[model samples]
Target: MRRFSRFVCIDWSGAVGEHPPGLALAMIGQAGAPELIAPKKRWSRQAVLEWLHGLADAREDILVGLDLSLGFPFIDRGSFFPQWDGSPDSARSLWECIDRLCADDPHLAATSFLRHPEARRHFRHAKGDTGDLFEGSIGRLREVERHQRVSKQANSWSCFNLVGAGQVGKSSLTGMRMMHRLEKRIPVWPFDPIPDSGPVIIEIYTSMAARAAGLPANTSKIRDLATLERALCVFEADTPAQLDRVDDHATDALLTVAWMRQASTVPALWTPQLLTPEIAQTEGWTFGVL
Candidate 1:
């Protein structure tokens, strides 16, 4: 299959609670205006799948980026451990085939689409008293999820609004977590802080080492952030400067960190590290490269 020449950004909502009066699909090409594809509220899942199938069939070598993770990841540790405890296939299917894959296989977990440098900058931890806000932030997200489930206006009426609610909840939770974690907090989504002038490209050069190693595309080992960092480093190093438009300072920091992450796969790479030993000793572990 041919990759898509253009980008496809999906702001998706699982519609766990509400259904909007109409479904909206916006398709933008390299040139010209965006095309809207809205189908009736009565369309069945089979019909929707058929339409999507046709859409995909029509495109040649298009890089079809989905808003949803193609699969689910099976959390082996932490709060969600003990794993799938005899859960039926329905749970997996309801979560979407890709998400289910991620849940069943550890390797297929996908990163959030908002991975640009600007986006990552905004996701910094909060400072001072709220230094450990990740937990609270998650709690807030659970609350938001609960609200969606019970809100009549949301559940009975506006289906499309489900996406809005989910986005709001996620943003709220993530932002709150950032604020709570602040010894000196940074913005989690600062588009305005960046200057609009000039072509400033933000990227994450992820390593395809796992993929290249013949690891299944949806394997259990591909979810580590460290693995992704290595990919990004390799990707950035191999690509020429013309491909990037960001300022040298910002690009350097990003690339350096990305390269440093290669240590996850090769400890010897740490011999000539860019980050200070002290900082690396503390912050390095957080990158999950190991």
Candidate 2:
């Protein structure tokens, strides 16, 4: 396993707006002090991609964890878009498909896929609406999501459900757009082969990181400085004094990076028995979920 020099966690947003409050990023290096990146700035998905590409170009040995699903539930059907004849067979291919379909969308937004007739049928985009698309699906949980639930007891929402605050479908689709671009410059964990050097991105769940920091499962967000500091301290990370004023997004980013820093030291995190070639190519695993 490679030792990463820097750890980054992005609290990504899937809102349709140009600048969503949910978009936030934080980073922590070997020094263990977390710092908020792009503070007070409303970021577009395009800008984030450019920044990540720059990091990869620099050959930075970093482990980047983005809070989004890398791929949808594919194991049961052997494909993400099973009904569609043009459905991609692998996760990377799916990202490429989303990118190609949403090529006209600005800021790497996934509006094209969301608005796609056949594709949109598989997702629930609004609250109070039932996701009838997945009613007859063979499995709702991706292999990794099932592992996360059984092992970690984390309630991971289906990537097909785009409604509600707990829903990650929108963010994940938008994130797939970003991943499609980033794959050209960086290696995405499980989906792509990890290079010997340079930046590598992985899927992350902030709640899992919070759990590793001893936070309760019900703690959806952390706004209190004391609680945030305690979470950072769990990994012996330095708590930023500015943490007191930040909102939940910033705090989540901070805690996630701290958790990533500590998680990098665990051998099992890099190589898990569940990470078979099939799972890697189909349903990507969440980093540190083991």
Candidate 3:
């Protein structure tokens, strides 16, 4: 496996207006501690994309992990938007579909897809919004999600569920728009073959990284500096003094990148049995699930 010089984790949000506290970016370089990027200013999705593009342009061998689903559940029908004539069968094609469907959305927003006549049928945007959406199914976990659940005994939410706070559907949809734009410049893992060099992106679950760092499952957010410092200590990472606040977004980003810095060294992370051509083309697996 190729070693990365920098590890970045982004805690993304799908909010429509100004970026929420949930949208945060954190990075750890080879020589320094993990710290939030633009800690003072809220970041719009467009701004975040520009920042990421700049990193790729700088020729840095970086590994970026975004806290969002790369693709929806596709194991059952071999397609995410099954039955729809134009529905894409691959994660990369799905990204293109979403980007094309939501072309008018500013800042890479996915409201267009959510409100799309046919696309909306597959997603649940709000509470009590019912349809034939498979998101409501009890055991619709993707292969990676199932692996994470069985191997780590963690609760993994379906990417199709977008109603509650635990749901990642909205964020994943918005992330798909970003991915479509970035795919040309930066390669996304599982979707694109792993490149021998240059920057690469992957889907990440922040909770998994936190659990790997010894944080309790019940603790939703790490606000205390001491607790956060201890978690960073697990990877021998320097804890930034600025992360004293109680925002889960910032903390999640910080800890995930720290965990990723360590995870990038593990060979199994890049090569898993679940990453077969079928899975890669249909349902992209999460980077750390295996």
Q: Please name the candidate that would achieve the greatest lDDT relative to the true structure.
A: 2
Summarize candidate 2's per-residue lDDT along 81-146 as a digit string, tens digits: 667788888888888999999999876778898787778767766655444565433227798887
Candidate 3 off by > 4 Å: 135-139, 244-246
Cα lDDT computed for each candidate against the true fold: 0.26, 0.83, 0.81
Report the lDDT tens digits of candidate 1 across residue range 133-159.
122332222111233335411211111
Cα lDDT of candidate 2 equals 0.83
Looking at model 3, residue 239 earns an lDDT score of: 79
Candidate 2 local lDDT, residue 36: 88
Better of 2 and 3 by lDDT: 2
- Per-candidate TM-scores read 0.29, 0.93, 0.93
- Model 3 residue 251 lDDT? 87
Q: Write the per-residue lDDT of candidate 3 for residues 120-150, one digit (tens) a residue.
A: 7776556677546555464266788877778
Candidate 2, residue 251: Cα displacement in angstroms equals 0.5
- What TM-score quantifies how close candidate 2 is to the native fold? 0.93
